[model samples]
Target: MHIFLHQFADNAAFNLRRLLCAALLACSVMTGCARYVDKPIDAHASSLLAPLDPQQISADTKAHPSTLLPVLDIDPTGPWNDMQIGLIAVLTNPGLKAARAQGGIAEAQVFAAGLLPDLQIGISADHPDSVGVVNAYGISAGFDIAALLLHSATRAKAKAAAAEVQKNIAWQEWTVANQARLLARRLPFLQQQQALATDAENTAQNLLGLTTQNVDAGNAKLDDLALRRVALLDTTERAHTLARDIETTRLSLNQTLGATPEQRLPFAAKSIARDFSTLDANSLFETARSERLDLRALRDGYQSQQAETRHAILAQYPMPVLTLNRARDTTPIYSKGASVALTLPLWNRNRGAIAVAEATREQLRIEYESRLHETRAEIATQLTELQRIATQSELLRQQLQQMQPEIQALNNAVQRGDVALVTYETARAAHLDKQIAALALAQAAAEGEVTLELTVGVLLWQ
Candidate 1:
């Protein structure tokens, strides 16, 4: 009984040890799983709170502040003033370069067209007595005159078309460059307005701070502070909007200048000076009619079409063919002779070609008329816009002059604390609004003036 009891006690001890080991293994597994889950969560939280790198912060701080462009030193006595940037662009543009190359091609075509038909030569050998012997060797020369005549007219039309294409290309390049210069000039003024908006925002913030201080000192109500804060926020947002617009304009101007957006450019604030020297609109229109390259190109096209129609009608009468042939033969019978050949106009008269050419000439005439009418209408519309904007600009200038003293008085009153905060704020806002409006009016007037100058071929920029 004692042995059995001892064995039972040993068995009980072994079971207790096994239970303790199992419990320890389970605890270890659960602790490892908990640690694995917590690791990712902790890492994510740390990443969220990570501070910005000092190097990046310093680099950003060192970036240059945006600045207004400086004025360019344009030569007053140079031919550059007489010619607009448009003319320069036309001279330097790649499209015009390609068009000019077409002139060389047209010249080559003339050579091809005027070439006389190639002479034909033939040689024959015969064997008479089992040994090869030169029985007959002949050379013949012949040409068709009709082919040359047709080619000459075609070459002339090609040359005329090439010339018109070159002129049209030049006109297009000039228009694009003119528009670019105008846009570049306007960009600086837009930037100036953006800066003004920034100043207004800063002023609003300063006023808000002052109001907050007054409220803290029991000199102003909480509502007054809140109102000033709201105003400041509104002004700040306006400044931001204006700044964004200015950036967009700047990028567009840069693109026009053929520069990357990151590249810096200097474009001065430019205003169109009123030309005390004014020419009659009718006179200007006449000058444009004579000087405009696109119009001249169209006229050239019409003349070419007329020439083509005449050539095609002439083609209906089969061109008389004149051929000269010379042949030499030796061996079986020796013969040498020169003969002239001619073809009668019998079956094929170019009636279809004549009809097509006449129809094309009519189409060209219609196109020319349409282009002229459109150009004249454009000129009239641009002139009217220029006049209207000029009148509006003068009125705005007068209004600004009249408001100057009043704005100054209001500014002084606010600085002296004689005006209520809300009254001062409102007056300041009005002044700023008027200034922005005046600037916009001025810009529109300048644009219109430039457009008129372009339409009339009056050079505006040096």
Candidate 2:
């Protein structure tokens, strides 16, 4: 009995030593595993308040090619035209930066998806409470065969998703840049309107003062004095309204450029660089249908959905987990074998997932078609409106020119005391009104140009 007990103790000690070796190896492996470090977020905002120097941006862009869409060779200190301002907005806009960061995560996801999963390892231990029994243990090593089969489709989907994300980010950057361009174009026109309104206001104030003097002397009718006061009020309101619009547009432009609200820019008088009068709307829409970043992103999204659908369909097949194991039991029997755990396509068969994936693909198809139609219609509408503005602007310019001779005649007549001062003032204010209208049309044309560029996803401006 003592001999048997010593033999059992010897077997137990051997098993215990084997278990200790396994534990030591596991510890060694865990030492090479990933460790986490604390990462804290900053409480304060890290917004860049001041703009980068233009020359430095130009230099940097030259040294390391700019990734900006619709890249331009911009002279920063030169005229801040629509394209130049747009480039600036793309460079500095906070929203675009955040979007690009999201795109980076998408790219990283592609890398992760391409990686092969690690082999699974499992260990089991059993202890016997009575004598004539030894310690038992099992060790298994293998992988999910189903995951290996689906890897190609999964990686393709991730790649397509990453491409879609990047294209969408580019589209967003284009939109923000165009917004800044529109406001920059608008600011100058608002300033011009204010100047014209100021001239009219000055003329009306003089006329009102003269009319009041004549009324006090019983030389002017009360109705004429009332007319002069009304004219002065109209001019004053116009000036104030234009001034307010200017300030508002300035603030908006600064915000789009990622600058402080009160920041000032050297706004140029002429904002439009290229003419769309020659380009047919139909032709432009055709080009945009293929070239627009958003549309391209939709195609990429559709491709990714296709991949997802394929993956789901592939999943309907039986998934298998293959493992090879070596074990020793409490009876002192040793074993080694390979086994497979297969998931049968019973009632489920991954039908729900397949259906969902196909439905999602169909939804993306519908969305892309709808967006295409909207894009075409908007291009046509904006182009037609821009043409109308140009026509109106031309007509107004002709009218102003036609009035120039009469205005000169009125000036001479007033100097000779043959025309009333109020009459000359009325003619001057009317000319100013036409000038303001012309400026409005011009500003609308500039803004429309930017919108069209954004819609078409091409730089029409040189």
Best by lDDT: 2
Model 1: weakest 10-residue lDDT segment is 64-73
lDDT of predicted model 1: 0.60
Question: In candidate 2, which residue ranges exceed 4 Å CA deviation?
Answer: 1-32, 43-60, 63-79, 272-276
Compute each candidate's TM-score over C-alphas.
Answer: 0.67, 0.90
Query: What is candidate 1's CA lDDT for residue 110?
Result: 53
lDDT of 2 by residue, 152-254 (tens): 9999999999999999998898789778878888888899889989998998999899889989999999999999899889999999999999999888877
lDDT per model vs. reference: 0.60, 0.82
RMSD versus native structure for model 2: 4.2
Report how far off residue 346 is in candidate 1 (Å). Answer: 5.8
Top of the candidates by TM-score: 2
How many steric clashes between backbone atoms does each model show? 0, 0
Model 1 agreement with the true structure over 1-462: per-residue lDDT tens digits? 223322332342334344346545755775554344445547665543443233332233234211111122233232222122233333333454566576677667656656667544333322233333332333344556566677766667766766676667656655655666567556666777777787778777777877877788898899988887898888788778877877887676555434456744444546755642353566667777777778888887877777688677767765654433322222334455665554455665667878888898889889878876776787777766667667776787888788788878877887899876656666666667677777776777666666766675545334
